[model samples]
Target: MTEQKLPAATRGPSDHTLRDQIVNAAMEYFSHYGFEKTTVSDLARSVGFSKAYIYKFFSSKQEIGEVICASCLTQITQRLNAALEEAPSATEKMQCLFQTLTVAGSELFFRERRLFDIAAAASRDRWSSAERYEAWLRETTVAILREGREAGEFERKTPLDETAAAVYLVLRPYADPVQLQAALDTAKEDASRLAALVLRSLAP
Candidate 1:
């Protein structure tokens, strides 16, 4: 797909300008062509630069994909936080979290499938951002479990962190993008079942 060309630099372009240009172009390329199919030359051509020039801003094309994945994950984390905050209790917050994650995964994996590919790729490579994102998920899950126990919304048979980890493991297939892709056609059914199961597990 064609994009609006960036304006010519009167002097040499700033590093930030070049980096933004490359990133924007790379995002477009990754969205339209998928990450594996896209080439640095294509990104360079889109930004009216040479491949070498593009490499000056990013070490490799995979680096650009990692940057995009990081940005997306940050946004996802923000949304998850907001969803959790909107609920009145920890149980409700956990339910909201499930719905929010399911909807987000559907959007990312079904609507913007290529972006999902990038995230999956970064996850496989154990990129720092991906690791950080996973850590955030676990921490957030544990925090919710602790809040529930403190508020008498859930039982105290197990440690909050252990229970949270177990819950996440049970829910991963429903919440994780790569794992949920095959269930896209049954989105509503899967989401309902997963939410019900988690809510039941956390019930007092």
Candidate 2:
């Protein structure tokens, strides 16, 4: 008498292409309106479907929200991974990353802005995945520092783990309600400088 939990795609559209469209439309609705404010009706219209049609694809708002959050996380990680692979030096990789976060003349587009908005609003009881994401970013920066140390790019004796954490800590305020005012007041503020402080911690 146990109920079966269906997979995301198989629960509705088995075709991967159609499932992507459903999620993309939902992403737009969620971003244009806050998660709680977005209705299934609005989401359905975005996809040229009826409210009933959406229910065929997703069980509830939470279900779609979870999928949206996961999709965004996967996307940014993929982008960062690709950038990391192309970078011969960690400094350049880290620089490329920070550049993406705040610089307009980069691949990180306005589309990414919505993802960040939703990520900040998701209802995850455990922050492990989010923390892990931040940790991975820190570790990537640390790896870059290690490479620099060997190549005579850095000369200091600071602890690597601490420096890595600091890199994220500087950005943490942007997500926090209190310090986020700085970001809201001016998007042009230098996240790169903060990241540079972390990078320089390894220098002599």
Best by TM-score: 1
User: Which numbered prediction scores highest in lDDT against the true structure?
Assistant: 1
Name the regions of candidate 1 deviating beyond 4 angstroms: 1-12
Candidate 2 vs. true structure, TM-score: 0.63
Q: What lDDT does the true structure give each of the candidates? A: 0.79, 0.61
Residue-by-residue lDDT tens digits, candidate 2, 173-195? 53332244346546435666766
**Would you give me the overall lDDT of model 1?**
0.79
Model 1, 1-204: lDDT tens per residue?
123334475567666777888898887888888888899999999999888767666778888888888898887888888888889998888877777887776776578766887887777788788788888888888888888899998989877767888888866665556677777788667776777798787788
TM-score on alpha carbons, each prediction = 0.86, 0.63
Each candidate: how many clashes?
0, 3
Provide the lDDT at 77 for model 1: 83
lDDT score, residue 10, model 2? Answer: 62
